[model samples]
Target: MIEEPKTGMNIIVKTVTRLTTGLILLFGIYIVFHGHILSEGGFAGGVVIALSFIHLMLAYGREIVLKKMSEKVSELLGNIGAVIFIIIAVLGLFTGGYLFFDFFGKGKPFNLFSAGLMPLYNIAISLIVGAGLFTVFVTLVFFRSEKK
Candidate 1:
């Protein structure tokens, strides 16, 4: 019987990535589940959720893979997600007629489904973050490595 070579990561890196990814997912679930109670806001919660996977990449990604992932799409998407958050904040100007208004607060703390367009931004952040991590990992694994 033939055995397959490891895809990329060493045993320790793979183990670390698995553990970190699991923990991050747990933390993200915690934040998303209770974001309203804490009043930390959904967008922030979404970012926290997204960052959890990023931690995995940083911990376990191969050197070449990490460099490539860090340099390109991951970085681009990270910045874009950041910009999206800013844009969401800027959108408040239109809704509140000023910056950082209640934005459908209606004088009461909103539930998970309560926040107006804030949820939309939250979803967007989640998309960017998840995609950023996925992109980095997929690219790194599939990318052809140049011989040193």
Candidate 2:
């Protein structure tokens, strides 16, 4: 008797992906939040976050991953991130006479809230990077190469 093909990877891989996906996502978020105090920043953290979703797509199928985060949603998120970043810059310009000026108060040194607008910038950047990369990945996955 012939068996049907599986849509995604084998059960072992799927189980491992299921276990590790959340941890990857959390680690990315941690990197984004602690970037000012630590070495890693939004760009690094955003790549990690995007990797988590890509991991899911690789372990599962595109359909399953797309169900969780559709291309439209990813694009929308990226646009929203850009808008938020711009808004913050505009607010800073109006308040401090320069674009992206640190208008917020700088709290205690070595503290989580010490960076003024830096943390907010990191969050926005993470959103932009994560969504943009994910969208690109999806588009590449759907791209079809024609045979000569």
Number of backbone collisions per candidate: 0, 0
**Model 2: per-residue Cα lDDT over 1-148, one tens digit each:** 4354378888788889999999999999999999999998999999999999999999888889889999999999999989999999999999989998898899898998887999989999999999999999888776443242
Per-model TM-score versus the true fold:
0.47, 0.91
lDDT by candidate, in order shown: 0.60, 0.91
Worst 10 contiguous positions by lDDT, candidate 1: 1-10
Highest TM-score against the true fold, candidate: 2
With candidate 2 superimposed using the best TM-score fit, by how many Å does residue 36's alpha carbon deviate from the native? 0.3
* Candidate 1 lDDT score relative to the true structure: 0.60
In model 1, the clashing pairs are none
Cα lDDT of model 1 by residue, 93-135, tens digit: 8987876555765334546566455555655566566556556
Stretches of candidate 2 exceeding 4 Å from the true structure: 1-5, 143-148
